[model samples]
Target: MFAMLVDFASPVSLDWLTLSVIPILFYYFVYTIYSLYFSPLANYPGPFFAKISSWPNFYHSTTGYRHIWIWQCHQKYGDAFRFKPDGVLFNSPSAYRTIYNSRANVKKGKFYEIWPRNTQNINTLTTIDKSAHGRKRRVLNSAFSEKAIRSAAGFVSEHVDRWNEVFLADNDGKEWTSPKNMSKMADYLVFDIMGDLCFGKSFELKEPGENEFRHMPHTIAEYMQFMYPASMITQSPMMKFWVWLKPRGLDSLFESMLPKNIRSYYEFVEANVARRQKEEEVLKRSDAEEGRGRNDLFHYLFNATDELGNPGYNTDELYAEANLLIIAGSDTTATTLVGFWFYITRNLRVYEKLVKEIRTAFDRAEDIQVGTTLSSCNYLQACIDEVLRAAPAGVADLVREVLPGGLEIEGGRLPEGTQLGVAQWSIMHHEESFGDPWTFRPERWIADSSTGVTPEDVARARSAFNPFTIGAGNCVGQKFAMEELLITVARTLWRMDARLVPGDNLGAGSSKLGWGSRDKNHIVLRDAWISIKDGPMVQFRKRVD
Candidate 1:
């Protein structure tokens, strides 16, 4: 009986356990072998798998510097290099054109998936569906048109006036350094404008330091950094769950999000939506008053119509889309202006030329209005462009998934679904693409054949200088952002005499975070000491006669 029992079941069951584990081990082993030596990426060079994976990004990108890795990759492997097994970093001007201006066949990749407000609301600004995105864009497109922007100039002017009164009034009539508060100042002004124009209410962030709205920028900065790691995971649909599973990156970012503060900003957006809706109701009653008094982007956008041939977005959709404006329009303007300040301060000669231009153009600081600054200040605009080239949100390297048909990048055929983009840093710094790529020469942008850059060169460089991106997925707020940057930077120059407060520079003090989709450096504040968060502190003696 015992022998029968053993032969029938017992020994066989033991073998089954071994059999089960055997396949699992074998599968893993094969996976390792494929990843190491035989996968599609095996030929492309990069740091070892462990370095390329999420761990280094999670650790280095968060606590200290993530940009260093990108710089290292380009240095080690030349322009076209592998960052991860699936992701390729194309660090050339040509590659940038290929990735950004891909044929209509290739749409925006899954990387932008997290840009939507939430699960329920996917608006035009964030949705990847081309037709849907196009439809949404059509309705909203009118407001951002050049004429519309000219009309909205006063809106920015009003905010700058409010900011000047709040900050400059505290100077006690002496050329003193009061905590180089440009970063915070820039934040308040940008957020306030974003709030009022989009939501129809000003947070008034530029007041005496204690304003609750002042912290909105910091809160945003925190949220932006916190989201990317989770955001990176979001692009990987299958790995989405990993973000919430106490991954170190997720944990840090989640902790940083600080619901109380983020909700304040969220509440502001929600409130702005409500206010905008009420205004739209009034607008319908009197779209007749037209350009008389009520001139905000809200009126135009809310009253817009979609391709489905109906009044565009509903209440919630309006709210979400407006917030996209907030996210896209606000900090970008502030950051660009802030970065512009950094660049100008470093190059005192550029600073003098810009200031001379602004001061010569407008006698008073407040007199330097948006439309006027935008129209005549070619040098100012060029300076702004150079800054964008030097420090773009899409600067590090943008990624695009090659569609099913594959891509011909720089004469090489990349397989479909292969992620690629031009390295903004590389392209902007390319000797061939930019002439003297490192030199901060604004005259290069002036329409002149004498400088060796013809209108064709200008067009080529302009195409290459896509700080706001290009083609379908380009930043819809580019015009608005440009207006803001030019206005704000011009005013700051006109009002103050700025310089690098002695030994310090404009780079980030701790780590440059919150550049949404770029690898930025030295972007912190530096007024008194060389710290990044403190911002530039110039001796503004109020440019008296």
Candidate 2:
């Protein structure tokens, strides 16, 4: 009787186990069917798993391979392809204009909100509201205007000279010395420049002793490493429970989950903002009494007024903008500088040509200033352009959402509420737009009658190049950033001779996509929101000539 009872119970347990898994299996079956045939994006071509879920793209993003994967997808699936269930990636230049420029109905997508800021208040970078972004941009434009950049040029030049001095002293009069990583040095120099511009103070990052903000760039990189995955999880229904539990004093739990570096970065910005506010009040009183005020970014923000005389950013907004400025103003310029050095060193011909142009243009390093003769060095400009094209700072998609009426793209009309963006890395490197796209050929940008590059080549390159992005919501600091690059690159190359240390992995490896995609031919970039670059271990010596 006991044995018969045990046999019956085993079958009952088996039935329970089978029933438990049925709902999960059914859900996956439904998801696969909808993703493959029944969904709105069913007609779009993409990896089957990508069509079914956002995880594949998210995983690539987390692994620092998002741009490479997108480029591969573009190669496999044509210009327009689905990268996520609700997202479409474009590789055509026209598609870039249509989505980002024609801002009639579309707006920045929900993906941007994943950037951690004040939950109640969004900054210019993360704001999805078009009108709000426009308003913020208008006020901020005063700080990034031509007059402001020109005013800041003296400050920028001073820092650039100081950086050269630091490098020289570090070498201790050696003919050539390998500083190991130019990337970290570039970060220090740019961070100091940003500190001066944003807070009216220099972090003195290039100086000897420990500086509090010296680790900021690394901290920001570390913080961004987890942000992509965290953002994905934050957007899901699971976050709803956290919100619901907030009233029960669970807010600290969420805050506790934030990385220590991110919190410190916020505190650093907050302190600076508070200090600047105090200084602004004093400056206002001083202006009333002595008729003088500073011209730094904080001063501009504090005094900025819209067309209607509306006050500029509030305290929290100031904090957000200041934080964004630190990252954008520093990291992008630093990344480009690092990539520029890597390419110029790897390609000796390009480096020699650039050095000749810069050296011929400026008799002395002091003469290389923004908006001066340095801008006329066409080859130098071409090298800068090539660097931006080859290794754009922002490697990932800059997504925008389709609005109520839907939107037209290169391939077809995207349905309403669909997210669309150009995969910059893919588009800039597209074979259809550029011949031998992977090659570091700055001559392609130069319209020399002798070089044999046709006007068509120049036109195609112009149409495809958008390192600072395009449209109404493009980078406000574009002019300033270009000026910084022009001055820094020209000055550094003029003062120092640079070459790669023998055995560094930075542009050295087997080719991947093409000859240009070789590990050794191009700077290997790791994307963590912004492209993080490592060693080309360049050795530098003071040029006697």
Candidate 3:
């Protein structure tokens, strides 16, 4: 029987290689034609290659230009465009609401699942089920309550005060300190703050002395770079195979593939969580009052209760959420601070105005805490708003999958099973929203008739501005984030005078960075869900009376 089968194939000289290649090539050709002219999304405009495959999205992600690529497409294609064969991206405020609002007929895109280590590791951010997300969010909300925020403010102040002193090192009050990379400084400060709050012990990345965890921030960035594009590949033609493989052995494969730095980050989070849990157990056993009085974020989460009054999270769940808090709490704040320094240092006029407002708002640096007095500083808030608008930390879309019955957006209806979102970078920089979108003008946020920024102008801009995004999936800790920003900027400016190192522009965009990101004044960011950025090298001097 084997000899007869071999003799039959030898007649035409047909080989396994030719037979396998023919079907794949033929299938791709037919699929491309259908995707370009026959699919529900055929009418959407975008790059030709993007209309047929997910490679464009994957390639741009690898280059750290995925956000820019989306913006460039929107510039050519108008408010809506196809980013992947099955994905559509929008560049309007209404579209954003339609996709992400609480009542929107959509859930998180499937690509979100690629980030979790396994089913047990899925946290609030990666959960695709709407009901599961809601349950998780409710329990997590306890950690960011009004009372928790008031307590968190104390931690913020402690870290910010120490951070400021570090800037003045190696300098006398009479002269400016050497040029410091504000990006790296911001990372250390925010990372330490997050470590202290979430783990009950500061990583102390900001201190002058050596520390083992000093490279953790860079490790986190490296891990994001690997995961972001890998997630995008889940939408490619290999989606089915990838999805099937994940539960079988891909989890172990990914663990093996991670670089040493990335592995170290995982080990660090695991160690910290284990140590904190043991400490909590001791406190609960010996001194319940001490455990109840502990005000770190982990305390709230550790003590959180479900509707039935059971513990909200188990050990595995706690370990998973620890990663979430570190990235969400630290990276978002640090990215904003980096962008703020880039703009404020270059624009001296704006810097002087902000300095006057901050100094006048508080009598001493210690007075700049989270309160009514701090909240009243309009310029400081405007500055922060402008930073978010121009250089948002999460520049890419928070993608979602259309549910059954589809969604109506921007004067058209999308079919069910469509993956879509608003490109945050494109929408925030769109001309329809901000007349001078490329300019860094905090005054755009302040409603002043004399400056020609009328209430209507500010309202229109506010409608389009969603740095923390909106609706159910919005940043759960937005108020806490704002409190940190306000305190960091206000206190720093109150104690020190900052200026750009002469002719240094490490983070600013240039012509070489390609279209939609060429303005020299605009700060450039590499999107990795959260942003990765560099410097606006700056020098600071103590404010003389």
Candidate 4:
């Protein structure tokens, strides 16, 4: 039977197997050739290994200090450096205006294409089409308008009670409460608070003064690390080809490699979206009655329609935007305050100054509500802005690619399709940009002659600091996020006495750019998330009062 089968198949064909090998070799040959000659990136200079190959750049990004390395490259080369075969590392301030500021030609890269939800409509960040982004932004614009935000502050204001509870939770009397980490507790409070306001979904992350959830921060840390590689690999046209030919973005195969702590995260926003859709029909019917109130972010978003009068957020759009809100509203602000809190916590002097200012401003924690917390706290706003500039949730120098016509930036010629942008971290730290760039001088934020800072200094200092970004291409949610950060930080300071213990440090995720605020990798020193930020750590016998 074997002989008969072999005969019928005309024996083993080395030809077929050999043909497959040829294509495999040919693909690499083409890759190598283009990587050398025809590739438009051929002339650009980069690390010798990266210019010759893609492995070095991809692997470096995966190793966790990708920001440091990119900063190194920008320092070594001039403003624009070819990071890999396709992606370029830029460190020029003017590059920002060229790429992100100019709206006519550039839109977000398709590298963000994989980010769109398979089950939902495209989100603000994922829309590669300019028209779609414009349309979505227009509809979403009114919700974040000054009037709308002032209205929404009502929801943000309510979370302070929950926050206060966390502060006083386990205080039996002690010093610095055994080294608690503020990041997690702050995150739980922020995430749940934002989730409730945005989707009416209560994650209940905060209880008294502690976080019920541990997985959220770990999940987020993992997700950021996972996405960080894209800045190197996916942004590069060459390496992206290699990855695509194989498997794809984070699937089960990759998820299996992560620690179980990271693996256990629940998609709270996703679950909430599915849960909320049922209520919309009820809301629409109740809309007929005069006193049947239906007003919250969820209601407004759910009821909002497109230009054609179609209801806001078809099921797909609903989930995507809600998921985005969970990410946007919580993560950015939490990250900002975590860094801010870390800085003030370590610098007892700054913390004291902030405390005095906050204490005098609010009669009580309850009175220091969101709107009032932000409005009355001028120094608080300045400190928050300084923190943001020092350690922004995202370093600006946001990239924009010059399309067919090319962009002429800072009066210099940039070829068509040059991907470039300024480095916010570098600029913010430049000795020329900030005096004694390494020191955390919150005094620079205040009007003071003690630091030798003058009115002329303030006027000239504008160029050195561009944290929320400037101009038309700046962050869309800047106003809302700013209000939230200031209120959250000031209110926390007003209620709790945050102080850093000696020998304590921010973990690996922080950038150690000289004099810049510390960025931590976010490991907890002690307690639950909500408890850590509650502060003073039992040092006081009576109370801060």
What's the residue-level lDDT of 291 in candidate 2? 23
- Model 1 stretches with alpha carbons more than 4 Å out: 1-25, 50-64, 102-104, 115-117, 235-238, 241-258, 286-288, 370-374, 435-439, 447-463, 505-534
lDDT of 2 at 72: 83
Candidate 3 residue-wise lDDT, 1-545, digit = tens: 87865664573546766787899999999999999999999999999999999888999999998999999888898899999899999998888888889999998887887888876898999988989889889999987889888888998999999999988987775699999998889999999998889887788999998888888888888888888998888877667577668889998888888778678778888898898888777777876784365678888888788788988899989988888999888888999999899999989899999999998888999988887898899999999999988888898999999899988988888988899998788888989889999898999998888898999999899889998888889999899999999999999999999989998979888988798778888898998877999998999999864
Candidate 2 global Cα RMSD? 3.4
What's the CA error at residue 204 for candidate 1, in Å?
A: 0.4
Best by TM-score: 3
Best by the lDDT measure: 3
Q: Each model's number of backbone clashes?
A: 8, 5, 0, 17
lDDT (Cα, tens digit) per residue for candidate 4, span 28-59: 78887886677666765677666656577667
**Candidate 1 vs 2: which has more lDDT:** 2
Q: Which stretches of candidate 4 lie above 4 Å from their native place?
A: 1-45, 52-54, 102-104, 119-121, 172-176, 208-213, 239-267, 288-294, 370-376, 395-399, 459-461, 470-474, 508-545
Question: What TM-scores do the predictions have?
Answer: 0.83, 0.92, 0.95, 0.79
lDDT of 2 by residue, 1-545 (tens): 87865664587878987898899899989977887897777888999788877778778777776788888888889888888777788888788788778464688766676674436446788887878888898888987877788877888899998988777786664577745477888898998888888888787888878777677889888878767666544333325353345445554565778677667767777888899889888878766543255577777788888888877888888888888888888878998888888788888998888898888888899988876587788888889899898888888788787889888677577788787788778887888778878899999997778999988889988998888887777898989888888888888889988888876665444555343345567676776768877766788889856
lDDT of 1 by residue, 222-248 (tens): 666665555555444347465335443
lDDT of 1 at 496: 60
